[model samples]
Target: MVINLAMKILIGIPFVFGLLVYKLRTRHLSTFNAIENFLRSQNNLMPISYSYSDIKKMTKGFREKLGEGGYGSVYKGKLRSGRDVAVKILGKNKSNGQDFINEVTTTGRIHHVNIVRLVGYCADMSHCALVYDFMPNGSLEKYLCCKKSGIHSLTWEKKQAITLGVAQGIEYLHRGCDMRILHFDIKPHNILLDDNFTPKISDFGLAKSYSNETSIVTITAARGTIGYVAPELINRGIGAVSYKADVYSFGMLLMEMLSLKKNLIQNTELSSQYFPDWIYDHFNKSKDLEIGDAEELGCEERKITRKMTIVALWCIQMNPVDRPSMSKVMEEKFREKFNLVRGGFYTDEVQGS
Candidate 1:
């Protein structure tokens, strides 16, 4: 009798656990279905929905992979109208579809020359994807950091143009939009370029929105690339969370463009690490910047480099309050007045202006 009772108890335990698992799975599916339905209802203005089969057809069975990142893999595809597009396939193992939802909702409403346009999306069960205009030049990281292999031939003027365009896009997100959007990730990898070398801000998975009534938004934790993350986000002692975090990232990006080196260095001599500090020291002492092959640079190129360096230095100030706003950074008056002197100093007239 005792042996029979013990066997029955074990059987009942498995049965109860199975029932609980089934109920949890059903709840999850119900919630997902509701969110998917809501997204589909709002598809007219934003991105149109595509079935999983349609995504497969567009990507040609994932034949041509453009790249892969922390989120998922991107493939190069062609639309029915023969237009080129890049399709991003989100990984299925994600904890939830929050990243997918965040990207779709945030990028759908934004329309700007410097911001990448979301053509469409796919939210089929277990398969999520986003479609965007094909950027021929890919990301800005290749142009700045990969120039050693002679792949990128961008001149200083073009680099400056890209910087200005990206700044304008960020300014629009911060001030022009109905709600202030904070781009948690603002690195070179997120900046896509078109055939004409025009820079467009891409990747909104980590983006967050706040209303004008709130100046400081609370974040559960730090959300950005390590090298580019603002000191404030990493350590609350630095300052409160604000749009200035994006400014700091942009400053780091600008410095990378000027120096043509990756900010994070590993397996290198101790003295060579922390390139930004070295750059600041050089600038303070009126020393020549260590850009590769200085003799090959023209006078105009030198001037542009100097202007960008000074602006980047100001943008990367330790205190968020000391950093200039994106609007001020985009001011034509400031650019027009900037005149770099031979001694790595600017004219007093420009400063006063």
Candidate 2:
């Protein structure tokens, strides 16, 4: 009996030691894998891999200015293949390295027809820039708000198509990826228009990704442009943050598209009383609104456009839950048309689709 008991103890000790060794090895492998993924993600984040010198040669010392935004100045360039590109140079010694990393990490991996493509990047000290496929038409904001271009390039059908494309791009960002990507910024300016007039969603620097269980990401300070920011985000200091903030911004963008007006009216009775708050309140009081530049649209087109305005209002509802999902937005745009009309005019300003 004593010999058998001693044998059992010796075998059990070896078994326990072996289990510990296996566990340690597994953990070490996991850590190594994470490190590997981070490095690999960084290495391949930007699609274009040109050396800084090659980029300078293409831009000709940043000769042709394309545009400027909150990030930096953009210059036009043509690659060896004769493909035009937009080169965005970040400010020298800029403090927003994290934003740069986010742009590279997220935008680099995303490839879709409606989303802007990141052709390359330059991350050397004293200089940081991102290269993207040059969008010839500039942004939707320019056509809608800027008057410099005397003629109206965007027709009624074009507006509908642009709206559809933008929605599709946002839907792709939210649900098309392996992870859920929240575009913390979704204003008109972030939406670029291609030569073909397709709306391509751009600027991933302010975006955030979350897992299924994460309801919110901790933010040290408020992010996103004002007027376009969601109410919850504006009030983020008082409560936790969530992805729904994005939905709210989308709502604002929708309203902007509907009205063809910037939502930044300050100290006006209209903004405090009617702009956002009135959208839903007016909807409740009356199911739709007749909005848009009436001078540009025909009576029949104006009626159809009103239906779209109603849909936009639906998207911009104060409650995130009230806003439809991106999939639903697509369905609303394509699946059906509203017949709510008065004498060949849809009671609403535009059709939802």
Candidate 3:
């Protein structure tokens, strides 16, 4: 009887082990399927997986140098199909694998004239890269900071157009997406300009999604660039950071656009301080409105340029609520005269009152 009992137990052990293996395999497949569903819902056009070898060849071992961002350095390259692409190769030392995935998946879903397009990505565990439509003019940062050599200086009109485009892009991300996308980080470096000087918002690694029903989500760590960071980030803890933070960043960006100077050190004065505040501080004065030298302007369109500056100040108000929505910004910008119904500067409410 003892021998027979041992034989039955031995057989049962193998059976149970086999069953466990099968269940584990099934679970993994199910999880993969769910992830796939989420990607589809986000309108991702899942490009075929490309190996690290393929990318290296396409970029000629990353020969053509483009500018670098927080995550990685971008290289201009040509694909197998004679297509031009901007390849962002993530640094092994600086960023993580998750950031690459976020940049790819978040940008892939977003399709807008004002927003940059993500062509594809490479995730080989060790080598990470992001492919995007090549923008010849490069980033807005180059113009404001570097002063492109021998190139025609940025006209006041061009800057106005760029500002309008960028505002519209942000507005679209907030309201147009299936889920509201908070850029979290908005700066001149992230704004890429095409051949025609159209602005496209890029770099979505830090982007977060929220629904209209939910407000004030929790975050453990602080994220975003210096100077462009909203006041809420410094005073309150991480969790308090909200969509309004993005508005503050936008305001800072506007200040930079007008002053044509790096406003981070100046913006830190707090309470809509720095260039935007300075502009508003002197909006009533002719000299202040002429921050951008008229000589830089090709045409004698002074009145219109002054109005654009006022709109930018409105965007950078101390209170997030006082800032106009991206859509409203676009409408008011193109209009001959923008009567901001919500009186001058609201420091209490994040959105314009």
Candidate 4:
């Protein structure tokens, strides 16, 4: 009888522990869900929350994929209102949820022509996604870098307009906002164009925000694409970290637009060669900016190209302090004065000596 009692107790002990474990797990999950709900409700201007089911319905079962990146895949979807939207379904493998939060918070309050509009987002457990206004013309890279057939179709005027639009957008982020927002990733791929070719800045996954009083922000890790990342970001010893990093990125992008070539060609023997050096040399030698179909370019086109080139050079200065503030770059007087045709001595104006 004692032996039988011992066997029964052993079986009961295993069952009891299993029951406790299951209950504990259930309670923890409930607490987690409650906290998440509270946080979601706290965002005053938060974007509309969509459920996982809603995302699936809106996306029509991921029917059309727009593109894919390190973040995740983007699919073309339609809202119930019959409006089109681009749904970015974040990858499940992302270790941290910071990028998802960053994009939503950074873009939610911003309302500008040059900035991409964040329609809404989904944070249903492990399934996360972001919805944006569908860009009809797609990314600027498709026009400038790829689709060689359409390169010439983007006239110098359109290119200049796109560059100006991007600058204005960055300027808004830097000064127009309640806090300064630094776009760590600024490249051709991030600039989207509408049906009318209006450029809007997108992809704020790597962006950072700081108060006006803050001069230098501590960077935990290097941010931005390789070719476009500022020298200061790669090596803090080079210069202080500030909005100037974005300026460097914009400069690299501007150079790419002018040169009509990829800034960094991978796995090539000439990878060591930097294109900015060629830009300076070309300027000094009075060589034509190797804009494709240069013979077809009119006088105004040349003027715009020269002005953009000069501004780009100033932005990419080795020292962060040397770069002009975005506000200064957008000033009317500065724009008018710099637009004048100088005899291949545009550097003098850029140097401001």
Q: What would the TM-scores of all predictions be?
A: 0.83, 0.76, 0.74, 0.81
What lDDT tens digits, residue by residue, belong to model 1 across residues 1-353?
99999999999999999999998788667656755865866643566678889888988999999999888899998889998999998876542667777787778887899999999888766677999999999999887766544868687889889999999999898898888998989988999999998999999988999996777879989999977888788788878889888988998888788763442233435346455555555556676555564667889887887678777766676667666677778875126444435433343432322
lDDT of 3 at 346: 40
lDDT of 4 by residue, 1-353 (tens): 99999999999999999999998667655544653655466656546778888889998999999999998999999999999999998875542566776687688778899999999888765677889999999998877665545543587788888988999999999989998899999998999998899999999988998897887888898998988999889888888899989988998888788763453334546556665554455456665555555566789987887677677776777778767777777773125344323233233344422
Superposed by TM-score, candidate 3 places the C-alpha of residue 269 at a distance from the truth, in angstroms, of 12
Query: Which one wins on TM-score?
Result: 1
Clashes of each: 0, 14, 7, 0
lDDT of 3 by residue, 1-353 (tens): 99999999999999999999998666645543544454445554544456789888889998988877567788988888998899888876544345655666667767899999888777564667788999988889878874534374586668778887888888888788887788888998899999999999988888888785665645666789977877566657322566767766776787677663443334445446554455444443433334545564544456556666566666666555556666666655545344433324443322442
Better lDDT candidate (1, 2): 1
Give me the overall lDDT of model 1.
Answer: 0.78
lDDT of 1 at 72: 87
**Higher-lDDT candidate among 3 and 4?**
4
User: Residues 154-197, candidate 2, lDDT per residue (tens digit)?
Assistant: 67678788878888888887778877788888888999988889
Residue 91 lDDT (model 2): 62
Where does model 3 exceed 4 Å of error? 1-43, 46-48, 94-96, 146-152, 237-240, 260-290, 295-300, 334-353
